[model samples]
Target: MRTVEEHQAVVTGLLAPLPVEDVPLAAAAGRVVATDLPALVSLPGFANSAMDGYAARHAEVGTASEAAPVRLPVGADIPAGRTDVPPLLPGTVHRIMTGAPLPEGADVVVPVERTDGATDVVTITGAPDVGTHLRHAGEDIRAGDLALPAGTALGAAQLGLAAAVGYASVPVRRRPRVLVLSTGSELVEPGRPLQPGQIYESNSVLLAAAVADAGGDARTLHFVPDDVDQFLTTVRAELAGADLLVTSGGVSAGAYEVVKDAFRGLGTVEFAKVAMQPGGPQGAGTVDGVPVVTLPGNPVSSFVSFEVFVRPALRRALGHTSPDRLRTTARLTTALRSPAGRRQFLRGRFDGEVVTQVGGPGSHLVAHLARANCLVVVPEDVTELPAGAEVVVVLIEGALQ
Candidate 1:
């Protein structure tokens, strides 16, 4: 039997970083930048106003107040996006809107609220310091400065910054193409009436969604029969376009284990029993030069196996700096017992400081898995943990708090 870390390392070694491709900024969200991106132009490219006000020389209106106002002639009306701006002459002001470029020789901006509403001439009742309400050129970022560094993940704010820095498209690692397949003789699709001996096939849907959440492009193949030759042929036919082949079923020690029976003789793939609860039977290698990872048929086992092994590998291949799920320590709300010599990942619900077990340690309990936001880890040597014991929890569904 192999340890969990050994299997994780073996699975992670199967994939390499994908090639970088230029994608439009609209489609660059959730992708990692492949190289450092420099700003094409400085932020606020020119001096502009931060508020709708009057742009004037501070020396002219430095002592103006509400009781004794300093009246000045309005030389021009400047709104945002005006490229050709006239200069402010001595003892004059320009009516400026927010984001409008400041005219030459103007050193301050007095907000319109402090002055009476006027068009031909304006009243400057309040005095502002020089450079007040002014957005200086290159204040946020200078031209040719680093806008985004390599390995930075692009989110809403990152994409906005990229667009503001004059990037229409960005270079990012291509999403890995994953092909999901499930196999069983007594499996039937959902929404169809099930016979007495048949059960609904759900591993493909579960695995495919997990792949997409891990930043991989996923495509599912219909369940194959439990025949070895047919499974091998079907898998080979799809390997030409897939970067990784993920299958859930038939890898355990059983008479009808087609995945183990089909690939055991091949020199490329290896099957092993990992010393972990819910996800013991694991296999990984290449099939026709495309990487393949086989998981257990139980829904919880399949989901946990994907979370532990495949998800991180896919993210690493996509150039994510942090490939693993967020992990934190929380005190257990109730006592629990784990099997000796096997690492256990129990479904849990974490509320910042305390973690409560969702259900019993059963791999077939899919409902319990759905309600869980985290996985409470118990090491191989820990047979029993009393209440209030600090346990490591991996946040699987945004349980950051």
Candidate 2:
């Protein structure tokens, strides 16, 4: 039996970044960059006004104050969008609107609150430091600078940053295609009639959503019956265009183990009764030249294994630079024990300072997963842990709600 770290290493080692594609900037959120995005042009493309005010030379308004103001003839009325205006002449002020391009030879800007409102003759009553209330050219971003690093997962801020640097489209990674299969004869799809010995085939839906959440293009195939040749036929046909294949329920030890039976001759399925509870029955290897992984049937077991193994792999394959789950140590609020030979993962709610179990440790407790934010990691070779002992936990979710 492999240790938790051993299996985790196996999973992480199989991940590599996917290929890149040029996509529009509007649709680049949550996508990864396959190439460096360098700034082509400067932000604030040209010198512009930061406020709705008069653009003037500070020397023209020498000692301009409320008691004795300096008045100059308005040379040019520059609104926000006008680009054909001439430069501000000496001894004159330009009535510049917010975001208006700064006229040449303008060294200062005075807001309307400090000046009398007039389109022809502008009176300045306040004193401002030179170069104040003005946005210089390339002040925010410069040309030929590193806009974003490679392998960056582009978010709203990143897309906006790239757009600010004049990028209409970005080079991003394409989302990986996935086929999620749920195999079981005792399963039925949701919103359908369930006869005796049948439950909703939710694993496929759950895993498919999880795959999409991890940045993959996933399609679910549920309720594949426990038939060998028929299942093999489906696997052969449906595995097209998928970067990775995932299946549930047929990998575990049982009489109707379709995945375990069907993939015996085609590929190497090294079964591992891992040194971990709930998700112990795990298998991973190539299936006819493609990487396929099998997770246990139970919802909690499958979800836990996905967090512990598959999600990181998919994130990596989708171009996540650092694809590992965050782990932290916290004081336990409840006493718990684990089997001597298998590491146990307990669902729990974790504050930054402490962790408390959501419910008792059980492989089938699906409800506890809703209220928990992380899994309290209990390793093998330990039987009991008293309350208040510090234990390591994998942060499945952050900032518990």
Alpha-carbon RMSD to native, per candidate: 1.7, 2.3
**Candidate 2 residue-wise lDDT, 1-401, digit = tens:** 78777887676665556787899988888888888888989987888888888999888885899999999999989999897979888888999999999999998889888898799998889858998888888887789989888878888898889888888988877897878988878888788998988888778877887887788889887667689999988788887777778888777777879988898767576677778887998888777666788889888888888888899888887777876778999999878888898888999888899999897777678778878898898878888999999999888753338
Off by over 4 Å in 2: 13-16, 327-329, 381-383, 397-400
| TM-score result, candidate 2 | 0.92
Clashing pairs in 2: none
Give the per-residue lDDT of model 1 (tens digit) for 214-328.
9899999987878889888877887888999999999998799998888876778899999999899999998888899999999999999999999999999888889999999
RMSD of 2: 2.3
lDDT of 2 at 141: 75
The 0-to-1 C-alpha lDDT of every candidate, in the order given, reads: 0.93, 0.83
TM-score of each: 0.96, 0.92
